[model samples]
Target: KYRNLLLPMHMAIRCHEYLRHTAAAQITYKITRSRSIQVELGKAESFRETLKATQGPCNTSKPSMLDFVNKAKWDAWKSLGSVSQEEARQQYVDLISSLVGTEAPAVAAQPTGSTKGFQTLLVSTEDNITTIRLNRPEKKNAITVEMYNELIEALDLAGKDDSVITVITGSGDYYCSGNDLNNFTKIPEGGVEKLAKESGELLRRYVKVYIDFPKPLIGVINGPAVGVSVTLLGLFDVVYATEKATFHTPFSQLGQSPEGCSSYLFPKIMGAAKASEMLLFNKKLTAAQACEVGLVTEVFPESSFQSEVWTRLKAYAKLPRNSLALSKQLIRVVEKEKLHAVNDAEVERLVERWLSDECMQAIMSFFQAKSKL
Candidate 1:
């Protein structure tokens, strides 16, 4: 833990403590031994206990490697290039497994199905519950233009595949870090103005898919969700989140506006003040806070989040399919007209925003910083 915890002053103290632990215990860690990050064999057998003892203040709030990685913060891409969502997710699962002293089951390829051949996502259906995982954990599951296009196809496929419900979740520790900036670097032959128009249309169409989803869309907030990814939660029928999950919409900070009809629904569900803070002031909400304010359906402990969310989803999938569909449709009936209008409005606003000097300033400033690096 000390190795990953990033402490400068504790080196010598850690060295002394490590030596003490080594004298008391038999094994120093496999590679590290600065402070004997090992448990006394007879003192604790459980992984959690051993971890707690080996790393004092095991749950410290200090900046950590895991946190930085999970948050997708990097100086540049070289050290941890552009990893696919699936790979990033596996890295997170592996990290958690290491912390708990167990090898997590690798997310294996499902037997051949419609989900096959996808590069940025994993699709599978079991017990009538179709799951669409944002599989690019390598970039913190950041959505690329291709991913957005693929998701449109995946959701449409699920709608017709006799799947009763579709569950959307991130592959690993982070739900989504939003749009991959690389998507912008590839300007089409027409230039950025043309690209901006196309981007707005692409987002507009995708948001429509969310608005008109034939089946219930459930979001499993396995970890933090950022940017446009958080905006779509408003369209989810139900949302389950782990304690570690956070919903951050930094639109104002990033020179964007709320998409996915969040501008319409967030105020209705969480009140205008909260919505303003999230959309305009750059607010971040944790799992419990999200649930209390109605952004999340339920919150579960991180240790058992996967089991808890899937168990309920599978059971829900067993209910009468038509009944679920009809129920969802009926509930959404009142919002049909409003959703369409807001989606278009958001698109118009987004197009104007892209052309605005404010947004250009933000983009230029960001790229300038990157260039300096």
Candidate 2:
């Protein structure tokens, strides 16, 4: 459906030029932030392919081994193999659309045929605010593999949309119950090794979206948050919680290491000793305690949480959008590279943990205990 919206080759060329100029302009003011090296490389590769799709392949001899950038760009173009030029052009246009804030909605309002709408989230935009609410109340909004993909898509859209602020919360009483353990039980034909690698990659992309979010991201924690849900708050610009809310990351209990760049941000936010009590010892903190320790910005009484938080957020959303976004980019620029590195290291460690006997045993025991209950 979105393919019909592709910009022509000449327009795509102009778009690339525009991006370069905009990036240069923003850099001059120190408001432009660096994306992960991988994302930047991918964009470069896509631009190269777009050129090849319009113009013929590069005329020069193959890039030498020492020319890392040229070699990678050449390889990316070569990877298209027999794909049609039109297809390559379409792919390049899609990439540009995402970067230039022209992406279609993550889920159409009335998707037809095989297109699916969001099943795990309720997304709505109003008054320059996009609220992405986790909707699986029956399961305390636990994140399944499918939800992970939807979240990444939603965040990407919200980041590129005209919204001035993006808010994340949950329906019902729980913000999130953490990862759905069932994700581990359904090993595919390729087995645990393949599953580990794929899951790690997916998780990496999930966290990357949060790290790279352009607009102000606010977390409204109405209830308990666990595991990745708790860890991810570190990426939010501000977090408001109800008196009922609690933050917990029982990673060690599940034989998992920290993720969501929590390993780095947590220490910075709460100091090494307090961060260790939660990340290393699995200490759960009440809303007041979390705020005291710097994990949450504030805690409101449960009775007034919704009204109070929304009122403040609505006021924030009315400010000059560009100023807010550019200021945020500047603040985040310094830590962006470090966050990406921590994310990579954390995901790598988690992949190893997921494949380990200790993690498997711990999970099995957890299930066993649940069954007996």
Global CA lDDT of candidate 1, please? 0.75
Best by TM-score: 2
Q: For model 2, how does the per-residue alpha-carbon lDDT over 1-373 read when each residue is reduced to its tens digit? A: 1111222246355434543554423321221232323334345554565655554445457799999977876776565566655565555545544444432234544322122269999888887788899999999999999999999999998898777999999999999999999999989999999999999999999999999999999999999999999999999999999999999999889888999999999999999999999999999999999999999999999989999999999999999999999999999999999999999999999999999999999999999999999
Compute each candidate's TM-score over C-alphas: 0.68, 0.70
**lDDT (Cα, tens digit) per residue for candidate 1, span 59-157:** 333345677652332222223434553444334333433433532334654453445457888998777888899999878999999999999998988
Model 1 scores worst on lDDT over the 10 consecutive residues at: 39-48
Clashes of each: 9, 0
Looking at candidate 2, the ten consecutive residues that score lowest on lDDT are: 27-36
lDDT of 1 at 97: 33
- Please report how far candidate 1 places residue 209 from its true position, in Å: 0.4
